[model samples]
Every structure is written in C-alpha cells, then in structure tokens.
Target chain A: MLTGVVPDARYWSYTLYGADDYLIPNQDQRYGYNAATMDYVPRDTLNPEASDQWIDQYQIKISADQQEGNWLPAGNNKALSITLRLYNASPTVYENLATIALPEIIKVN
Target chain B: MKKTLIYFLLFCASALVGRTVAIHYLPDYIYSRFSKMALSRPGAAVNQFSVLMAPDENAKLVVKPNPDFAYATLFYDLTDGPIHILGAMPDSIYWSVALYQENTVNFYVKNDMQYDSDTLNIIISDDAMDQEADIEQIVSPEKTGFVLIRVLVAERDEAHQKAISDYLNALQIP
Candidate 1:
C-alpha cells in the first residue's frame, strides 16, 4: 500500500513497471494514477471559498487482486518497481529531493 | 607455486576483460536494440518527430512512460549534416526537450521555465555553430541519438487533445 499527500504540481503520477523496466502489462489498461485521476479527500472542512485549507491526500493499493480505490495493478510479479513523476513541481520539492516527503510503501499480506 | 601464480593471472585477466565488456560494450549494445525497437514504431524515423499519444499498458516504446504527458520523439543522425528544430512553445503547464546519445547518455535538456520566449529555433549539430541572434545551438555528443519533447496535459479532454495537435502541427523539422 502507498499513501501520502499529493504534491502541489501541475501533474503527478505513479506508474508501475516490471523488473525489466517496461510497464506492467495488464488487461484493465490501468497503468497508474495521476492527480486528475486519483481519488482524494480534503483534510479540512473549511468554507467553500477558502481554497487554501484544502489538502488532497491519497492512498493507492498495489496488488494483483482488485482493490477498493486507487488500485495500481501489480500483476502476478512480486518484484516490481513504481515510478513517481511530478511535472512542474514546486521548487521546494526539487531542492529537497534528498529529504522530500515521499509516499510510504507498506508491505501488506 | 607456479600453477597457483598462473591461475591467479588467468582470474585477473578474465575479471578485467569482463569489466571492460560490461562497461564499454554492454550499454551500447542494449541501446542499439532499444533504438531499433523505438524506430520501428509506426511514423517514427530519423529527423522526423513522432507524436506519441498517452501511454497505457500497451505502450512499451520506452520505460516508465508518464500517462499525463504527451511525447514527441525524434531520432537524429548527424552524419550527413545538422538538423534544424523550430517550434513554438506550447501553452502547457510543463514542457521540455531532452536529448540523449545512442548510449543512453542525456546530453542536453531545456525546459519551459528555462526559456524566456515562446519560440524555439534550435540547431543540433556535432559541433557548435556560430550563434545567431535568435537561434539556440546544441552539440550532440553522438552522431546518432534521440530527441524527446514532453508536453504536459492536465486533462485528456478534447481541448487538450486539440492543443497538443496544434502544437505538433506548428513544430517544423527541416
């Protein structure tokens, strides 16, 4: 399972790749999730006009089986890779790449 | 004692040979195979930009393709002469042109934020040419390599698709 706060960027996605570095082939044609395609809920319940209080948090379940929401298909391979791409990312993210807050990958049985 | 010395020498020579092959020959061989597969794609060729739609499960031309970005890829062979790339910057959130040698070494990359004007007139050659007033020059390390342009699409709606199409149409390669 992968969970974190989506970065404030123009575009972001988490694409799953096979051990060979190519994309994992699946029948559903679902390779990954972008900021536009992801399902997220705001942390704060502020007034509708207060856009500054909204924080988009997301969780992605990566497994061979179908999950409830934001399912990144892992196929049958146990050893795979996931690439997180952020386009037009904030300067903070680029400057703090070594200390940036990345999604936590929890191994779920 | 003599046999032991000979065995040690053979092992050292084999290790050195293996290291050289792995470092020098392996990457080039792999890149050649990859370039062959990439060039075999329909509408993809040297010196011509091939606009690739959004990637999915079937998109295997490259590794780790972002679904939100539309790509215009071109392979250039500088053996004959230089290649001219002229295009206007797309009004997208993020865009960039990245160049890589045949050995998969990234030589140059210029993003939207790095440019001041909306127009780009780049001359890619093996050696640097005289700087013109409004032209940018890129000296590729390899005679044959690849150039990739990435355009970000926040949404896959009709408007975004048309915008990408218009951007591609405006780009001139000569």
Candidate 2:
C-alpha cells in the first residue's frame, strides 16, 4: 500500500504516471490526484482547521477491500512513479530535501 | 578506403556540431516564432490575459497540460513602456503565475502562497527604467516574452469548469 504524510505547502499535488511523463491511460480516465482534488481518508482524529493533519495524512490502500476518504487509484499495475509536487513550499522544505521525512510505501501480502 | 573513412569522420564531426547548435538554439527559435505569432494578432498586448483556445487532442501549443488548471497567457513587449500586471487573486485555491523570457527561461513567478492578495501587482521593467517601484518589481533582463497564469479548478463539474473558463476569459490587463 502506498502511503505518505504530504508536506505542508500552499499547493501540493501527487501525480502517478508511467515511467515517462506521459499520462497512463485508464478506464475511468483518472490519471492522478492533487491536494484540492484528492479525498481525505480519515485515519486520525485530528481536525483540519485546528491542525495541519488535513494536509499530512494520506493512505493509498491497494487492496480490493474498499475504505473511506477518496481512493488514490494507483493499483492495477499501471503506475511507475508517484510524483509529489509542492508549489509555494516552505523554505525549510527545500533546505532539507535531502533529509525530509516521507512515509513508507509498505507492501501488503 | 582510407580517404573515404576520413571523409566519413569529417562528416560525423560537422553533423555533431550542427546538432548541438540546433539543440541549443531550439528554445530561442520556438520562443521567437511563438512570440511573433502572438504579437501579430491585433489585440496582442502586455499585462493582459488572453485565454488560449480549448485543448485539441490532435495538437498542443505548450505541453503536458493539466485538465484541472485553466491556462491563459499574456504576450509582453517592453519596447513601448514597462507594463504592470495587477489584480488576479485566486479565491483560496491553487494558483501560479509564471513569466518566461525570450530564451524560454522562467525568469520570474509568484504563486498563491507567495503573494495571495486582492491587489496582485507586478511591474516588468528593463534596465532602462529610471523609475522604481515601491513594491518589488519583476526584473526582466529580456524585454520580450510571455506570462502564463494557471488557476486550479475547485470542482470537476461541467458548470464549475465553465465558470472557471469564464473567469479565466474575463481576466485581462487593466
């Protein structure tokens, strides 16, 4: 399962594309998802307005078992890379890119 | 056989140099071609938003378009005078305005987080300008280029898309 805590930025987007930058053709025509576009799958009890967890929590469940929030469709073996683009990002984000903390993409057996 | 091999080597060397020159000049060539095309139009002017034509599946002007963002461009020429771009505050959404130089380099840009306000203003000035801006101006070494505005659509509905398109189309240099 692909999961990560997205960075804090004015605008962030997670785009899953083929190895090349070309959009992967899909049945639903859903190529990727962005911060404004993606659904918030609740995993924590944190408030969006109160805390920054709204922009942090992200879990892409690969299993066929459906879950809450919005589905970040990366399954069906079509994705090659999930690009995280942070626009108007914090200065610290760029300063610490080499050591930035990113959640792991765990394998579900 | 030896003469033919030398001629082939000479040809390869010239071809490599030719390819390098073409590659290095490609961006400038494209920029000038497009810039002239844009300015040739009667309404082409600086600091104004011109909504690009709808995306054609068979053709593309730029490249790698995101359907969620509406694209608009402003062709600018500082020959007459320095132009000011003002008033494009995106309503709490993702937005970015970028300026490209004649050489196709992104010389200046401001995003929502950087400058999110009702009075979004930027003056593009060359070195010849004696006046100064109270606010920081977008300094451009090149006097000619284009500005692109990308606004993220909040909803995927047709009505919302149409609204976004209308909003984008309404944007112009005042």
Where's the lowest-lDDT run of ten residues in candidate 2 chain A? A70-79
State the C-alpha lDDT per candidate: 0.81, 0.65
The Cα RMSD in angstroms, rounded to one decimal, for candidate 1 relative to the true structure is 3.7
Q: Isolated chain A: TM-score per model?
A: 0.82, 0.66
lDDT of 1 by residue, A13-97 (tens): 8888877776777777677888878877545546534445446788899998999878988887778898888877888888888
Encode model 2's per-residue lDDT on A1-109: one tens digit a residue. 6677667666776655544444444444454566766755454455544443444566665433444555444444444666667767788888998888775777677
Q: What is the TM-score of chain B alone in each candidate?
A: 0.85, 0.75
Residue B173, candidate 1: Cα error in Å is 1.4
DockQ of each: 0.55, 0.17
Quote the lDDT for B163 in model 1. 87
What DockQ does candidate 2 score? Answer: 0.17
Candidate 2 lDDT over residue span B95-164, tens digit each: 7789898778898877676773644577777764555554447777877778888877645566877766
Q: List pairs with backbone clashes in candidate 1.
A: none
